[model samples]
Target: MSAEGSRAAQIKPFVRQALVCPVDKGPLLDAGDELYNPRLRVAYRIDADGIAVMLADEARKVDEAEHQRLTA
Candidate 1:
């Protein structure tokens, strides 16, 4: 099998279970060959078909920063 195809085969299960839009904490919908977060307006392309990635928004960053600040 081609590299891309093999990668996709490995990623399919993880994508189905673990891939969620970090910004909204909601399920990402597959958009053609890619995945998209409607709330964050970010599109994630599978890396070499093996890893599903999601870009978090500024709100998440701020939340994380605040969390760290509180913990510190």
Candidate 2:
């Protein structure tokens, strides 16, 4: 697997399962570089160290086109 894929998969299933959206407590999709919340149309960035930055204030709002790309 690629390095990025390995990094993304580093988060154990149990730990990943415990991560939820700060706004609605919905499940966050573990993308390689960020966690995506389709319901809220926002994304939480994952740092280079494979740490998800789950701060609500730090959430980057996704536009419709990007939202489609993410959810797709």
Candidate 3:
């Protein structure tokens, strides 16, 4: 598997339930190493260490198409 995919596999089960969007305080879905919030149109990066950087400043604001893709 790709590195990101591998990382996701390792981190998803441990962190998925605990991840939340720091901006909107909403649940996040695992999108590779990023945790995405469809409602907020943002994605938070998971570090190589398997820790999520959930800070708002660390979040990436996705466009509508990307949001749809991530959510899908």
TM-score of each: 0.49, 0.83, 0.78
* Model 1 misplacement above 4 A: 1-10, 57-72
Q: TM-score for model 1?
A: 0.49
Worst 10 residues of 2 by lDDT: 1-10
Which one wins on TM-score? Answer: 2
Residue-wise C-alpha lDDT for candidate 2, range 1-72, written one tens digit per residue? 553475446777787788899889999876557888999888898787877788999999989999877677
Q: Which regions of candidate 2 deviate over 4 angstroms?
A: 1-7
lDDT of each: 0.53, 0.81, 0.76
Tens-digit lDDT string for candidate 1 (1-72): 553444434566655677787767787655433455555555566566456656553222224443343234
Of models 1 and 3, which has the larger lDDT?
3
User: lDDT, candidate 3, residue 25?
Assistant: 76
Backbone clashes, candidate 1: 0
Pairs of colliding residues, candidate 2: none
Q: What overall lDDT, based on C-alpha atoms, would model 2 receive against the true structure?
A: 0.81
How does model 2 score by TM-score? 0.83
Candidate structures ordered by lDDT, highest first: 2, 3, 1
Clashing pairs in 3: none
